[model samples]
Target: MSTPVIFIHGLWLHASSWQPWADLFTEHGYQTLAPGWPGDAETVEESRANPDAIAGHGIDDVVEHFARIIKGLDTKPILVGHSFGGMIAQKLLGLDLGAAAVAIDAAQIKGVLPLPLSTLRSGFPVLSNPANSSKAVSLTPQQFRYAFGNAVSEEESQELFDKWSIPAPGKPLFEAAAANFNPHSPAKVDTANESRGPLLLIAGGKDHTVPEVVVRSTLKQYRHSHAVTDIIDFPDKAHSLTIDSGWREVAETSLTWLKEQNL
Candidate 1:
C-alpha cells in the first residue's frame, strides 16, 4: 500500500491550501492529510479575517503539530511542505517521523546564506514594525504581487490574491534568520543527518523569495545525504507553485518521483 501523504502549509495559509494537491495524491492511491497550522481557522475567509488567532506560530509549534499527526497515521507518511512549512518538514525528518520528504519553495536552511531583496521585502510588513511581532500583519497588494505572483499573469495573480492572501505571524521569520547560531533555536533543523530519508528539494524557477542561488547553495552544503537527494527546478513558476496555473504538473512530478521510491 502507498504510504500516507502529509501536507504542511506556509505562513498566511491554512491546511486547505493543500486541498488540490491532496486530491491529486488521493487519486493516485495515496492516503492524504493536510493539518492546519496551530490556531489557524477552519476556512480561508475565517483565517484571513482573524489573523490574531494564529499569530506567534513559530517553527517548533508547527513541527510538533505535524509530528503528532504523523504519529497518528497507520504508517510512516511521505511529508511534503511549502515555504515555512518546508522548514517544519525538515525538522519533522530530523525527528525521524516520515518515510521521505519533498520540500518545495522552502525557507532558508542552516547553510543557505543568500537572502534576496524580494525575500526581505516579503517579510517587510512584519519586520519593519516592532509591534508586528505580537500580531499578524497584512501584505499590500503590490507586495504580494512582487513576492508571490510575479511569475503568473495579472488575472491569475488577482484571483490568487483575492482567495488566498492573508496576514501571518512574524515570529517564525525572525527565528529562521538566527537558527544556525543559536543551539536552542527552535527553527534549527538537522539537514546534515544522512540517515533520515530521501529528500527532494523542489524550486520554483521564478520564485523571488527562494531564488535558485539559495536552493543551489543548500544542495551543495548537503552534498553527503545517504538517501537520494535531488532538485527539480520548475521554470516559469513563482513562489506560489502549489496552487499556481501549473500546480498539477508540479504535483504529478512529485508523485512520479515518489513512485520510484517506497510508495
Candidate 2:
C-alpha cells in the first residue's frame, strides 16, 4: 500500500490550502488528506460564513481531533503541518502516532522562551484582547500582510489574503502564550521522546510570526532525545511560504527530506 500523508494547516488559512502539496505528494505515490480543525466547514466560504463554528477550540482539541483521525488510518502516516498545525504535528509525532513529521514554520510550543517583538505583533489581533480567547478572530488585510505575507510582494499578499484566509479560534494563541506558566498547558510537546519518528523542522528566517530564533530554541528542546531531529531554514521566506508563490520550493524541500528518511 502507498504511504499515507496527512496535511495539517495552521491558523488563518483553511485546510484546503494544502491541496497543492497533497497533489504533489500524491503524484509521488503517497496517499494524502488535509483535515481541518474541529468545527471547520467543508469549504472556505462555509467557514467564513460561520465564525462561531470555529470559536473556542484550543491546541489540545486540535491535537485530539487529528489523533482520532490518525487512529482510523490503515497505518501510522507521515505528517506535514504548518503554523499551529506544525506544533500539532510535533505533538502527535512525540506520542509515536506518526511515521514521521515535517513541521513548517510551526508555532511556539511550551519550553520555547524567545518571544520576539514581531511574534508578539503578529499575534496581537488575538492576544490583545482577553475575551478574544473564546472567540474566532480574523485578521485584516494589513494584519495578514504582516503576519503571513511580509516576505512576498504587496499585490501577492493581498491575493493570498483573499484566497485562503479565515477566522481562527483565539484559544490556541492564548494557550500558547501562557504555555510556559501552565504546568499542563495544551501547547506542551514531548520533545524528549527518544524513540519517536524522525522530525524535520522548517523555519523561515524572515517570518515575523515564528522567526528563526524561535525555531532554533525549539530544536534545543530536543537535545536530550536520541531520536533524529533536523532543521532547514528558508532564509528569505515568511509565514506565507507554505501558501504563497514560493510554496513549491518549500514542498519540494519537505519531500526531499522525507525521501532521505526512507519513509
Candidate 3:
C-alpha cells in the first residue's frame, strides 16, 4: 500500500492552501490529508470574514489536535509540514508518530537561537502589541510581501496575499518566541528521541520569517540524535517557497527525497 501523507500548513493559511499540493501528491499515488488547526475556517474567505475563529490557539492545542488525527490513521504516514506546521511535525515525530517527515521553512522551537532582524520584523505585527497574545492578528499586504513573498514579483506577491492570507492566532507566535525562556513551554521538542523517524529539514535562503540561520540552529539541536537527520537548502527561495509559483519544484524535491528513503 502507498504510504499516506499528511500536509500541515502554517500561520495565515488554512488547509485549503494545501489543495494543490494534495492533488499533486495524489497524482503521484499518495493519499493525502490536509487537516486544519482547531477552529480553522473551511475556506480562506471564511477565515478572513471571521478572524475570531482563529484566535487564542496556542502551540500545545495545535499539537494535540494533529496528534489525535495521526493516531486514527491505520498506518504510520509520511508527514510534511511548512513553517509552524513544520514545528508540529517535529513534535509529532518526537512522539514516534510518523514513518518519515519533512519540514519546510519551519518555525523555531525551544532550543533554536539567533533571531534575525528580518524574523523579528516579520513578526512585528503580532509581537509589537502585548495585547495581541490573546487575539488574532492579520498581516497587511506589505507585511505579507516582506515576510512571505520577497523572492517573488510584487504582482505575484499581491496575488498570493489575496488568495491565501488570513488571520492567524497570535498566541502561538508569542509562545514560540518565549519558548527558550519558558521551562514549561509547549514549543519544546524532544530532539534527542531515538525513536523519531528519519527527518529532513528544508531551508529557504530568503525567507524572512524563518531564515536560514533559524533552520541551521534547529538542525544543530538535533545533531546529537541517533535518528537520521538531514537538511536541504534552496538559496533563492523565500518563506513562500511551498506556495509560490515554483511550489511544484519544491514538492517534487520532497517526493524524490522521500523515495530515496524508501518511504
> Cα lDDT of all candidates, in order?
0.81, 0.96, 0.92
Model 2 lDDT tens row, 235-263: 99999999999999999999999999998
**RMSD in Å for model 2:** 0.5
Candidates ranked, most accurate by TM-score first:
2, 3, 1
- Candidate 1, residue 9: Cα displacement in angstroms equals 0.7
Task: Please provide TM-scores, in order, for all candidate models, with all chains considered together.
Answer: 0.95, 0.99, 0.98
Q: What RMSD value applies to candidate 3?
A: 0.8
Worst 10 residues of 3 by lDDT: 12-21
TM-score of 2: 0.99
Clashes of each: 0, 0, 0
lDDT winner, 1 or 3: 3
Cα lDDT of model 1 overall? 0.81
Model 3 lDDT tens row, 22-138: 999999899899999888888888888988878999989998998899889999989999999999999988889889889999999999988999999999999999999989999
Q: Which is the leading candidate under lDDT?
A: 2
